[model samples]
Target: MATTPAPATKPLHLVYTVTNIQHKVRMLDGTKVSYSSWVKLFQLHAKGYKVMSHTDGTQSPAKTDTEYEAWAEIDAIVLQWIYGTLSDDLLVRVLVTESTAYEAWSRIKAIFLNNKGSRVAALEHEFNNLTLKSMSSLEAYCQKLKELGSQLNDVDCPVNDQQLVLQLVRGLPAEYDIITSYINQILPTWETACSMLELEHHR
Candidate 1:
């Protein structure tokens, strides 16, 4: 007698659906946001959907392997996600008929992350945008800003302690306006600024 087949409700292997990835990620306009941020969100999306290997270069199967065709199908879906999320100008530059998801991903990443200059620019942009939100503790905000400044310092673009202090002041919540004004008048060191912010945070 013939055996019964697997349940029809189960999705078959090799079946993939469009993620409409752009809605989950912004279109990379090469200026609106840093590429690292864009790519991080995209990678997180891929990881959640269990398709990260397609874009990360660690899971290519041999053509003769039984899983190869299914892998290719998923890879094609990943490639589509990459293409769909890119701006038209970026799409034209990195899009190639024969590219795998990994190839396209790397090309786009390199466009913004290739040089020391680019890295510094990106880090500074992120630092400049940092803010103390209600959801984050005051300590964390100060620490993150310091870390970004340190990263800039490490790249030979040293953020003087005064500049770091000013940046931290800029990100302060309005409740700290009085102390921030005092801090600015003093033009204290970053360490001094953090201490002031922390004391204000507790009040």
Candidate 2:
């Protein structure tokens, strides 16, 4: 089988016409616990457009390579995509005059990785302290707990299904005391726990 080589100029490709990417994906808020999801969304976007290599260094061509200039151009575009999606604080920290897409990407990643310990502690504390009284409603309590649990998992400090179920049962208002005690007797998944609580609320 014969294969046609790619164009020598990067921007000539139709996929290089990316703009307003910041509007497409949520910007990177430096203090957010949802950093992993944001990273996932950006990677998915980059992969769909055939530009993952510009950020991951998987297909990097050296300065002396024939495709080097084109690669650099594509990389710069990818860098701009990242810059556009970053919060002002984050952009200021990672931006460099001559940085490659991979350099900026890795530096930002390092920043999150280095703070994982503190993030884990803070999220865990908040999750543990969360209760139905603190939220607007039963649904809100569940939603916030789930968000915190997911965020903790993203930071590599996961709370297991059992723990989530337990925590959900633990935070109910006084009216839920009887149902909460009943729920505590069983080993339900988090979804089941939420459903049981809802059933109790309606009854």
Candidate 3:
């Protein structure tokens, strides 16, 4: 008869301050580190952060202040609170209104990459001028998108813009449900229009 397996050892509970935890996670064998090392990860986890471990962490992506993911992470954290998993603390405050602002800005970024030339620049301008006071409802976002679409009609498409847009939208954050909702509603229209335009221009 096989002997009973030895009692399993309890997993370690390591205490960590909110600060410096990110550094610890970046160290050796750190992926296996406990939750508290970066409690923020757990908080994000609850809110559905899909891009935790980048593909081959060895190849560092540019960590620029202007990088969309940096701002996206903030939106994700705020979304957690909006969804009620995270509590707003003095140190980790997240305002829903601010998160909504970024949501619109990210959508503008999406439109910019999908189109080309002066249209992208025009979208960048419009997004820069988007005021919190002006866009009080989701309808405002839809109107903004329509306004951008008309502007795109005036610009020439880049050679690879279609492929680039497909890849970028495909890779966008899944937790931004509202964005995804609008995407689902609009992507079919985008594909049909772009495909027809490409065929006309090439043929």
What TM-score fits each model? 0.59, 0.75, 0.21
For candidate 2, the lDDT comes to 0.82
- What clash count goes with each model? 0, 0, 0
Query: Model 1 compared with the native: what TM-score?
Result: 0.59
Which numbered prediction scores highest in TM-score against the true structure?
A: 2
Q: On residues 74-101, what C-alpha lDDT tens digit does candidate 2 reach at each position?
A: 8888888988888898888899898989
lDDT of each: 0.79, 0.82, 0.38
Candidate 2: pairs in clash: none
lDDT of 3 by residue, 10-98 (tens): 54222211233333232111122221222344435423433333211223235564655554554444333322322223113323345
C-alpha RMSD in Å of predicted model 2 compared with the true structure:
4.9
Error of 2 at 97 (Å): 2.7
What is the C-alpha local distance difference test score of candidate 1? Answer: 0.79
Collision count of model 1: 0
Error of 3 at 135 (Å): 2.0
Which consecutive 10 residues in model 2 have the weakest lDDT in total? 10-19
- Which 10-residue window in model 1 sums to the lowest lDDT? 10-19
Taking the tens digit of each residue's C-alpha lDDT, what string does model 1 give over 74-183? 88888888898888988999988798999998898676556879788888999898998832687778777866776666455778888888888888778889998999
